[model samples]
Target: MFDTIDFQALRRIGLSQALVAQMFNLQTEPADRLMRVTEVQRDRLRLHDGEAEHVAQVWPTLRIALQMQGESLVVGDWVAARRDDSLGDVCWAAARVPPVNHLVRRDSSGLRQVLVSNVDTALLVMGCGQDFNLRRLDRYLALVRLAGVAPVVVLSKADLLMDGGASRAEAVRRHLSGQVDVVALNGQEAASAQALSPWLAEGQTLVLLGSSGAGKSTLTNTLTGLAAQATGGVRGGDEHGRHTTTTRSMHRCASGACIIDTPGLRGLQVDADEAQLDAVFDDISSLAPMCRFRDCHHEDEPGCAVRSRVPAGRLLSYHKLQREAQRHEMTVLDRQRQAAEWKARGRFAKAVSRAKRG
Candidate 1:
């Protein structure tokens, strides 16, 4: 099904050689239709064929298979579906082509939530006022790094910034140690399109991550040259935006790039092993090796190299995120146990629903 796709069509939808190869290896049925997931609903999904959008549901077989693996289809995923024109063009997804990378986080329950997949770059949007928080941005950057994607910190609402967001931009640069790109712009204007053109080029897929009132949806409108996502107004005093965008959706830009806009996140939990956390906090990780104790937690321990050079606040944040990672760490049996528990809960819900109806 993958090889038969036209080269131009694949590029038009942001498909790379690696993803094409992965699809081919899946060896899906020839009758299956290849489409990309644009939105995921309760019992159905909206997909695109590089042209039009169609609503589809996960086939029963595929649903059970995904349940067993503790996974679910999400927006921005390329999937193979069976389309039935006789049923008024209904579609059923039966297979998914694994994404090159996925932006994910752990919910409060410690279960993995895949936000979006097959992404090349992540746009971390933050406002300069009440919506801004350096600690929150740290979690976002860590999530992107864990997903193995490049990140660009976008400071929205530059016009409203007291100093045109210059000081805030510089602060972010210093916080990240100038390792990632930073852009300050008025997201509601056309010039934001030019400021972010490098990441919005053809075939580059980007996801916008930020809190409400940070102008994610507005930026989507500007970049796509259309009202792709609904814009919301902020509260008069606090500047918190209403939850205008309730779900994630994909929008196509004139530049041939795809933009996935997500709803605001109140809190983001970075779930990973200590080694993974170390990668995100490379500054602390690099110095840990020089500590007197190999298992140093960068605390009161003597000769703690990480404690000496790194800022006290950063070291503390590392320990906090590391603790969350450890709480959810698992082996093979742990995964099986979690999957089984989920299935049991699903069955219990079904039973209760049936009883209530009876």
Candidate 2:
């Protein structure tokens, strides 16, 4: 908690001109220091106030307000906070600046979860070992696309494969039809960071997203040039890794780019609608117009261009994603309807009581 915080290091964390303008216009407490949250813990948050990081506390009201709004302050969020000299020099955050974009997803319970915000790119890391699955990668691509973040596929653990994972990486690149750049590299090597240098330029912010034991932490350690993240061994049978990194933490690379490392997700439930999913899966989307019927499900439909052109496995993946997206939409609509019905019932009970009292 200090009296002043300048915006000199704001660009290092991908603070855009629009976000600066928004923070400047916000009417908050007497705080000139703008800070970025690097880590969010159960009780406290590690905030970097442009110069240094400080473990700061939050106003109880601030937390309550965010909770009621169904929002939480995540890593990569810029916040306005102040240090009170009168209160024994303690720090307290007042308000959070809205993020430019959010990498959002849903869990198995259909609960909305925002992965990270203010991201410029998503490094979808997948181990070339047993972790290589094109189906899962397609799901990740859709989630990143729906969030409006640029996606870059990173094939880690290349050295483990017989052919250095080149063939596997090429397959992924080909699977996506080269819509995005795919890089195959050994995550433990120093050169791996250089391979991702294009996206690590100054002012760029990236997030590493993959299942547990996909080498996210290894890549992060290499990028930061420090053994800051812990690495664990994978199971021999399934080649699956443990959840070594449990929390989300952001670290600055030597290139001045910021990388946010997250825990390996068990499953990614896409919180997207049909139109949004279409925007990500271009193969099916491009051929849908040529179908005999506009509502062609692509299953046993005569003259279905999508079914004819799309690979059987690829089509199956698309159908599965479509089903999930549709179910998420229905669940959301049901929740809204239930809320409305409850509100109507409350109003009706009040009206009846008023008539009886009169």
Candidate 3:
């Protein structure tokens, strides 16, 4: 299905030519085949092999090796697998190719969860109406930036409203520091398909994320030129959409790029390092260095550059994001401590068992 793949698209998505060449080599080999993961069950993966697809259990050794490295294979990862000689109807994964990029989010308990792997572009889908939230966009941007993936903000359902009529798309562009591209489009329109074509080139991987009823599935279907994903209408009074897509799935674009469509996220916790947060809020970072005191909180501090530039609204937004980042760090640290304690307890139990046996 992905015959006319665009190498340029792959490059734009951050995949090196060398990596593509390696994937090509795997595809050429008859003994081992490369497959894109579609669904991840408890212990088995549902993978697509271009013409046919199947569910196969990974070799125990491969799983252990990946776990040891503190990494995991998520949906949209390219894996090399072959039929096991000893087991019938099972495939043994010999290797997992390095991901070009990944999109990660922290769960409620502050544990990092891989939303999707090997993503080339993260389509930040947001409704042009009431669902437009710049603060939420900041969270998504932080996550994508930390994952080393490019982000494209997509303002969906634009046709329903007037063009550039003081919408959320304009607000997002104003607040975001970097050259983040924002596209406002009506997913049902043919023009929307054309606008998103550049990112859908062969070997590229794109993942969509937004709140429920943000037109993510609709946009996904539009990009593929087929209604492969189901759609639901927004709520009666609010612009919020019902949860339409429950699972993450990968689809191939006409240009040979792959797209991962994900369910709506109720809350997006920022689990990125200070470097990424600094990159996202560069305006704040640049101002901090000029603060008279090294530990200036920008609150009633003399010669605080951040406070000097701030209007009431901008200052509030800046403090909100800063506090959020601090909270995220604290939560992550707590989770790490809990994990360490559990590991120590396990070691103690093992030692006691050995003594008892002796």
Candidate 4:
């Protein structure tokens, strides 16, 4: 039945020929249905099979297997499932179809949370007003760059800018130094959405990233040509807003590209390697090779090319992200030591409890 589905329809849903081939390879049973996860919930998933949408959940055994593999399903992930008539329109998600690539971030616990899978571009949306911050943009660029996805910076609410966002956009461009494409647009306008049309070509996938009231939902609505997501205004003083979009969701844009809009990220920790951070700061990274000392800290050091050429604030951001990355890279010995310490504490508490009981 899936074989009979038109490729064009599947393309609209972000299924490419390569992904279709991968789906076939992942399916073991003839009756298994191939579906793309559009929305993820606490215990259930919303899947679309390019024909119909269904509420789905992973089987018990499959859940255990996925846990053993340290993998969990997220939006934009292709999966193999089967229809179960007893569940009254629910399907059993059997397994995940491996993504070509995926974007992930670390939670406060340092556990990996896969945001979206198989996206080609990441639109790092920020407001032209009080929401614009180069440091936050750099962090986003590093995350996407690490995932091997192209990163684009889109400054929304240009209409609110005093000089039509031209000066602010130029400043952002100078900060980035042409490292990534930057676009300034009004999220509610169709013509403004057209500025991003190149990356939204058919079969491509894009994800939106920003803080609250950054116009992510408005842009998604404009691109999809549907008022699917609710938009809200920001506080005049701080430009902050209540969390309007609470979950990660995928939509098919009018250009046939799929877009995933996620909840506002209040705190972003880049789940990346030091090398990835360096890649985002290529100016500083390039000068590192010219430093006299191989392991130069670039602070009051002789022949420090990086220190001499790179701006202090930019270098500080690089160092900050580097420290964060190293902190998250828990070694085997470190994890074992942590576990042993917890166990020792637990045993000591148990002994104290036994003495108290006696």
lDDT of each: 0.85, 0.84, 0.74, 0.83
Q: Superposing every Cα of model 4 onto the true structure, what RMSD results? A: 7.6
| Pairs that clash in candidate 2 | none
- Assess every candidate by TM-score: 0.87, 0.87, 0.78, 0.87
User: Model 3 — which ten-residue stretch has the worst lDDT?
Assistant: 1-10
Candidate 4, superposed: residue stretches over 4 Å from native = 1-5, 330-358
True-vs-predicted CA distance for residue 326, candidate 3, Å: 3.8
lDDT of 2 by residue, 96-192 (tens): 8888888888978788988888889999999888899888988888889888899999999888889988899779866776779999998889998
Once fitted onto the true fold, the runs of candidate 2 whose alpha carbons sit more than 4 angstroms away are: 1-5, 86-90, 331-358
Clashing pairs in 3: 6-202, 213-241
Residue 33 of model 1 has an lDDT of: 68
Lowest summed-lDDT stretch of 10 residues in model 4?
A: 1-10
Cα distance off (Å), candidate 4, residue 246: 0.4
Return the lDDT, model 1, position 258: 93
Name the TM-score of candidate 2: 0.87
Runs in model 1 lying further than 4 Å from the true structure: 330-358
For candidate 1, the TM-score is: 0.87
